[model samples]
Target: MKSSILTRPFYYLWTTQTTANAADVLYIMALTVLVLNRTDSLVSAALMPLMRSGAQMLSGLIAPLLMNRFKLPALLLLSQTGQCILFLCLALYLQLNDNNSSLVLVFTLVFIMSFLDGWTVPARNALVPRLVAHEQGLLKANGLISVSDQVVQFAGWGLSGLIVAFLGPGHTLLLTVILYGLAAVFTLGVKEPPDVESVRRHTAEDNSAAPSSKWHTLTEGWKMIWQMSRLRLLTFMDIIDMLGGSVWVGAFTLAFVQVALGKGEEWWGFINGAYFAGTVGGGLLVLTLARAIGNRYLAAMLIGMAGYGILTALYAINTRPIIALILVLLMGPFAELSIVNRRTLIQRSVAKETLPKVLSAQASLLNLVFCISLLVMASLAEWFGIVNLYLLAAGLTLLALGVGLIGRRTFHNAADPGAGD
Candidate 1:
């Protein structure tokens, strides 16, 4: 079981990844609170998710070029380094500012943090299979990684709030830099496989022969989506679900705390962190009860998320801080199940070399949809009230439920799910 957890390469990858992700969770929650506290504006909070989505979009644009041009290790180093600088800048800006009028600077820092994050993820994800290259090890590695992610997210959210409460958001940002630095150190020693250069050369040969443009290569992914009906359908459903049902997160929850619930503004970090607590709880459930219960891939995701949606709607209606936190805790597991299954689906379905591109595309789609959803959800929260806005999400979740039922073909992928991760 220990070896199962530590399978050499994947274990090392997890060491770095867990630290990086923990920092991200904490940074995002803290950043959200800091921005809102300073500006007293909900729009400033949208900057958090917007910057996040922007990072994904930026990654989608540059992933292919970076993978082709530079070694993954070098790119990873540069990405982390850039993020470190951005984080340091953010920390300094916060310390120096006596006047709270520097809202734009906060937004700029969010974008920079997200941009570096985007550049980092592709190299990170693609590197995972390299560490645990065996076939059977795929599931174990994925499960272990999922577990690690939950652990990090669990700590990040829970501890960030506590830190913010005691030490201030500046200390929180400073801690984020330390975590990123640790990730960078762990990443420094990862040995690329011998075949990596040959793979690069082979790609160069193919590119030279036809001079196939990047846009052509990328849009090709879009075209292939339709050829694989199930992939296309799942992708479509993801986009729609994000835009329709998934929009009530990030700032909406903050808005709910301030506007509808009349909770004081200082607890935004705590509120967001509560949602991550739910994620950890949900993830543990997936790891434990999966075999004994509704264990199928698509079914598990649909059922889990729908259950979460109902709870979210209930939280929206209740408006009590305690009830909201309880429902958020329930939401954690469902969120993790959805994340893990979706990644599993992508890995199983897409070809090995194409995985990066496809994953980048998936990230792009999710980002685009989330951005739109944030905008709509923000406006709707203003107009309809956060409770009604959340209720609307519940209604849309029913639609996602229908789509999942219709696309039951995904459930069948476990038997032959291909080279994803």
Candidate 2:
């Protein structure tokens, strides 16, 4: 079973990707703490996420062009190596500078690194089918990827504060530099498929039409997603869900820890870790039932969405810290079930050649929504209070569930035709 899904090259690619992701979480968490400590201004600390999101928005828009032109392996190499260099520079800046003037440089590096990340997500997803080599294998591979990513996230976020406290910000930055450098090294071993040009040239006689104009080619991804009813609906669901999903972000959680829980800052870390730990459990459940999930994915996703809304609502009303933690922990499995199913559907539904573009468009669209949602939600939280904000989030999730029901047939059609119900 393992041999069917975990080929050698895929193993290397998975390892490289997971390591990069862990380092990303660790770096961002470290940077937030560092900035808050250095400036002692919440506004200054907030700018980092804003900068990263802005960079991601641009990156998502442009990544399709790069993916179409360059080989995936080359893009992966460049992104990893670029981040490694940026971290090294940030580490050096921290070591050398003694004033707030260096904050600009730190933000600049973060923006650039995040921009590089936008390209990496779509490319990685597009490349997965190639590495795994079969339709059945894709499900298992995605399950593994989901579980492993949650594990990495849990470890990275859980340990980051401790590591930072022990090593200090500069040393923490240096450690990330090392992690990203190692990620680059492993990425080098990924076996990229033949370039698109080579394949086209080999079949030139059979497909001799001139290529489409650059504008058409570049916009094709968006067009495909828009034209496909299922994809369009799924994309819409994602954007809507994120409106509520924004609350799970650290910014709001930090506020919740302070205002709602009446706990110290460290509870922020605990809540975040608990959420990821629950996702890990949910992913494991999905992995074990991957085949069954493939059959009823649409129902599973809708149920998951509904559960998230209900659970988040429950969490918001609870005054007890332990009870709140339990509610957040319960929230994770539902979110994971929906997310994993959604990703698998995309991979299965889209054509391989256009998958990168579709995925990139989706990422760009989602990131844009996230940036706006974070701002809007944060404002609403301030106006209405966190509990009311969560209730609003629950309302949005229920709305998404309604949309999911209306669009159920789209995903129902997506189930494996070969498999018996």
**Model 2 lDDT on a 0 to 1 scale:** 0.80
Encode model 2's per-residue lDDT on 307-348: one tens digit a residue: 888998888877778888888888888988888877777777
Each prediction's TM-score against the native? 0.81, 0.91
Top candidate (TM-score): 2
lDDT of 1 by residue, 27-87 (tens): 8877777877777887667667777787768667766665665667777777777787788
Give candidate 1's whole-model lDDT: 0.69
Candidate 1: list runs displaced more than 4 Å. 1-6, 29-40, 89-106, 136-139, 161-172, 192-197, 208-211, 244-250, 254-274, 289-295, 313-326, 410-421
Off by over 4 Å in 2: 1-3, 193-212, 412-421
Residue 366 Cα positional deviation in candidate 1, in Å, after optimal superposition: 1.1
Pairs that collide in candidate 1 are: 278-329, 278-332, 279-332, 282-333, 347-420, 348-418
